[model samples]
Target: MGVRFLHAADFHLGSQLAAGRGESTDHDETLESAVYTAVSRLFDLAISERVDFVIVAGDLYDTDSRSVRANAFLEEQFARLAEREIPAYVCYGNHDPVADAPTYVELPETVYEFDHEAPEEFCFPNADAPEARIWGQSYRDRHESRSMYRRFTPADDRIPNVGVLHTGLNPDGRRYVPVGRRDLAGKDDIHYWALGHVHDARVFDDEQPIAYPGVPQGRQITEPGPGGALLVELDAAGSCEMEFVPTSPVVWRSVAVDVGDESISSIPDIERHIERSVDDLAATTDRFDGTSVSVRDPEWEVDGYVCRWTLTGNGPVHETLGADPEAVYELTRRLRRTLAGRRPFVWTEAVRDETGPPIPAIDDLRGTDRVIDEFLALADEFDDAARDRFRDEVGMLWQPVDDHEEGRPDELALTDDRLDELVDRARERVLGELARRRAD
Candidate 1:
């Protein structure tokens, strides 16, 4: 029989999801427990599959300072594996490095935590007469700039050799353990590289699998889709086959719905449009059973989605929405209520009004008058100047507020994307004001 095992990483336990922020007490508990729930499901799958062993690459906890509950949950899971005689190999990532304060809780005998000093090898069946060899190393501290890949010695080529490490593959700066695909791939003796740190489920090459099983549960809008572990099957010849199993209880999604020419004149119309969009999403999820049935399958499913809705495109109700922030908030609440009232519930975390006024053609007003010409010229100037100077201008307003706060910095840094947002808002506000004045 072929040797089978589960590959997973970046559990990030004790991490709080932003989706639960400002939510009801029960909702907050659900969101907080979602990560743990996903982890439990992963263990459940491992037990059911009766895999020989489980490999957890790293970041099992969000930080060294974990809650007692998080500690208890981990011990419970490891004990479950021990009961079935299935071994677990784990390495520590930057988030839960060796130098971090100990939890004082002992892991089960079935669990093998890699040493921080050097690469250690664990053999399946028995070390004296091994069928598979797994090598791994934990992080010595929170920041490991050097490449740990060099420390790994080649295992015997006769059996399936798996090398596990927590690294930031070809990262921009030195933060976590830095290593490259070629660095590990160059090792001929290693049949598989079980990687962690990056929270996006990826398989580098099928021949010698180098995979990151991402976070089991997405904790924010940025981590969209289904997060799960990889199941690897190794034949007697040592050839491998891999499959991903979805385990996240709740999926975080950011969806944009265009209501440009949909005759949406009021908040109710916008609400209906949003409801239809949610329905479409639900239908799509149900049709594929949460996994995308396309070539570019994101491997994300939404049994229950925490969504950030963006209303896009020019519409008649644009001015109405922009004019009243309270109305938009109320609309968001109503949308959330409407979605939650339905099956496969959706919680609308946020609603962004990206709609613009249905203005006349720019060509029609180009040279009509001085005000129009001046306004158009100013808009162009603003776009160009905003790119370079908007951050400084905004920082002046933000710095004073930040300074007053205890932990806030004196200067606020803005990302390129955030700058673009500010520029778009400025342009819209200018044009809207001009149009309103002209109408007057």
Candidate 2:
């Protein structure tokens, strides 16, 4: 009468975590195998929850090459699913190995991969007494441009209709299967759209729920926080209930320690600040709500944290932070030496010096000097530049708009928030310099 299933996507099985950029450590083993670990936990959760089926929308592999280990790993995990009679539905995405006919690693009988050529339909529990009708298609090549959803014609029945796609949505459907949200929402017959391609999970709470479970594991700093699959249940009456479950063993956290607000004056003070933050992170990781994960849950799933720290805000310690050119390097080494050995290990990927020289307010700076006022006025002119617009323009100019840019992506030096911080710091320095000159 009711169907319970797990909706997941972007397994990226052979994917490797970004490594060798920073100091080497014991956790390199953890980083080396994090993706595989997350996926193993995914199946473990599926068996524990006893879900009827699992939907893996796309990007099941990282590249076109056949990896013995990645393949063997899937075969093993899927076999575990088979032992429990839990079927996994799979499709391929841009980064998947489907660019050519795959010499797939032998998986279990329970793994039901959809046709890569066209949209096809299958009934859950069988066509004779179907509870759910599922339709999906896979990418035949690395570059898939077909609007596969257009071919979906679910049989006329009272059964719940579910649709699956690996799409770029409407933005640039020209390359990655050009189906839009409006179009997906317009399909009255389909009760749920299980989508992929986008690594960030998103859900629409319309009459018909549309969702992307995102990547089951985050591979880098950009793909941080709780990464997992969706637990979904649809009742006979067509009401759907969903919950996100975190499966990542390692979580990438962007830690913004405001040295100014906390009066963090020394390496010890900074360490204490970070320690408190880690305690908060660990205590609450298991309690993450789907609201944070709906676009934005745990085994309390963290095993370790890989952090990128940005020392923000202006303060007396800002000068202290900048006093030594190696200040950030030294502080980061301290954190690594202290925290990485603790339970649920904390590792520092890097430390950034964004802290600024503490200065008086613009209001105080104004009416004091004519040149300072003119400079402040000029800075204010650029303040009107929208953060969103700047990011988009910068991305278009620098980062290519394509699925799966080759190789590990370099860390983006400027983010929207980073841009704001830099602007604020610049203003602080200008004001501080002007004030010093005036005092002279």
Candidate 3:
């Protein structure tokens, strides 16, 4: 029978999700428990699927001064695997390097950690006659620039050979173990290479299969979706097949919304557009097909999603937004208040204003309107002195936060380019107001 196992990395168990924009209503526990929950899901998969073993490439913890809570969580999970007679292999990465220190919470005997001194081999089940051979090493310090894959050649490649490593995967990179793709392909005897350090899960199709399982849960908005692990099958002929299975119960998404289109003139209208976007996200299929990774449990169910919204496109709403920082901040607060209580709740992290004034072409309005033509003429003459005056007028917006305020506004840096952008926004506001009066 062929051998089966789980490949994963970058658990970062001790890290907590950032409080984006603000914390949610009735979901602080949900946010805090996400990382641990995801890790638990992976362990559940290993036992349920009855994998022969598990391999963690690296970064099992977020820091070398590991927290007792994180230590206990991992020990509990390892014990679960041991009960099923399934063993686990681990190599510590930069975040959790080997320091000649003992673990606070002892892991079960089924756990095997690779040495940091050099690349070492461990036979699966027993060394006398084994189904597979796995090799890897740990980071003695925070940085490992030396080549480790050069020593990965298996003594007997008759059975399947697997390599589990934590690398940046760029042969030229000096921080993480820089192993080139070509070098990995050259080691054709190894049927699979499990890699880590890059936090987005991806599979590279070389002569043999190489994969990065990525962080099981995202701590920040930049790392989106259900970060996960891989399920693999290996035959005696060194043939390998792998599939990605998401383990995160909480996902992060960046949603782009065109805030001030012609149809979106009111708060309710903007809310409708955001609601539609959320519905679309909820309805879309799990996104692994285009990535060329098969799914085992493709269900997209999750506790919730945190979204960072970018409001794009132009309309009359430019009369109130993007120019004054307060306008955008208030809009985000309004949105969060409206969307915080739904099932599988959607949290609005922040909203950016990229809107503009809704008006006709300047050339078209030039011949028909005298006031606009005069304003345009004066606007052309509004130079550095005028911009400096405008900056002085808006200087109060960046004043250090008041004791009454929840958070401080970003410091205003009115460089030449920024001044020009602000000047254009002022012009847009004037034109937009003029256009509204003309219709009246």
Candidate 4:
């Protein structure tokens, strides 16, 4: 018989979510609860599937300063697992280092939390198949600059070995337990490597089955799309099969709607367009639901969507949306209100106006050097300058406010790719202005 287990990490319990500007505390609380709800679904899945064990790579809690409620939630979930006779192996991540975890809250006997002081291995001997060994270590402190993988060595006995660690794959620095893919692949005895820290679910290798299940639920707009866990089945022959199981109640999505078409002229027309977009998103969810064939699994059903809308393309409506920011805000508010009254709700967290004025073809404006040509050249210069400014100055804004700050998170720094996007928007705006002037 095969050894079945679920792999997940970065629960980040008690972490605050990003709410819309001026949103009430109640709404923010609801968003926060959505994450926990997703976690509960994970435990439920373990019990329902009768998996022999569950592997939580790390970052169960968002921080050492986690709330009592978050601690209780974990205890309750573990107790549920214990009742089902399913064991859970967990390692502490940087966010919830072993040294910092509250001593008052106790984990259930069924849960095997790796020791922070040294690397440890737990072996489960099956009556009918080869024994399985799981090797792991917890974060001793918030910053483990060295590679933790060095401390781990597969057990001597010929058995199915699984390695778990909260690490990054050749990250920017040694801040997070950085381990190379080749280093993991070099381990001859280890059949699977379950990793954590990164929030996007990905598979590094299929044969040996190295994977990151990502965060079960996304807490910010930046972490768009469904977040979930991985279900792994390992046979006696040392082969592994894995499946991704999404568990997020609310999915974050960013969508761009082009308004260059002549039909989209007024705010109401834009509203209708947004309605169609929401319906389209719902239809997509519906299709997934139909194909999933499992109503009990939360991964199969998308309860709702939180979207960030970006309006693009050149038209008269672009001028209106760009000229009046309030109108755009109102449109977002109206869409949110309208969607709230329906099933498969969609909340518009933000609306960005990236629309530009309609312009004549570049071929027509080829000789008109003073307007279109001059603007294009200037746009090119601005793009280079913008990239430099962001690279140098923007990082300072994300630095720690003080040495003692605990809960303060690092600001999301702008990347070169993001800078290129901003430059593109700026170019469009400049062209739109020049075109309007030429028409006038």
Please tell me which predicted candidate would have the highest lDDT against the true structure. Answer: 3
| Candidate 3 lDDT over residue span 1-440, tens digit each | 46899999999989998747464478788889989988898998899899999999998999988789999999999999998899999999988899754489998988999999999998898799788889998888778777788888788677878888888766876767877878888987788898888776777777788788878888876567778799999876756778888888777886768765687776566777888888755522253455556876546478888887877556766666646668767777877877667778777777776666677766777756777778878877887888778768888564422111122333333455656766676777787677667756
Candidate 3 error regions (>4 Å) = 21-24, 100-102, 283-292, 297-300, 359-440
What's the CA error at residue 91 for candidate 3, in Å? 0.6
Give the residue spans of candidate 1 off by over 4 A.
235-238, 282-303, 360-440
Tens-digit lDDT track of model 4 for 1-440: 45889999999998765646365432444466888988998998888888889999989998877678888899999999998888899998888898856755788988899998888888764335546888999998998766767767764536678899888765445566767778888776788899998776667663476788888888777666777788888864666777777788778777888887888988888988878877656312221222211222443577677888889888789777767769998898787777755566677778888787787666676667676877666666765666677668767554322111122342333446656776676666777677778778
Off by over 4 Å in 2: 19-24, 99-101, 235-237, 261-269, 283-297, 316-325, 361-367, 370-440
Compared with the true structure, all predictions reach lDDT values of: 0.75, 0.76, 0.78, 0.75
Tell me the lDDT of candidate 4. 0.75
lDDT of 2 by residue, 1-440 (tens): 67889898888888786632376787888888889988988888899999988888988778767577887888998899898888887877777736465665778877878888678887886778888888998888777778888788987637778888888675454677877778888887888889887675667776678887777778877676778888888754658887877788887777787777546678788777777877755522332244433322254547788888887776777877778888777888898989899788888888877776666777888878898888888877775456556676667454422333322564443445567876776777777788778777
TM-score for predicted model 1 compared with the true structure: 0.78
Error of 2 at 357 (Å): 2.1
Candidate 3 residue pairs that clash: none
Candidates arranged by TM-score, highest first:
2, 4, 3, 1
Error of 2 at 421 (Å): 6.3
Give the lDDT of residue 142 in candidate 2: 74
The top-ranked prediction according to TM-score is: 2
* lDDT of each residue in 169-193, candidate 1, tens digit only: 7534475766667777888778889
For model 2, give the 10-residue run with minimal summed lDDT.
287-296
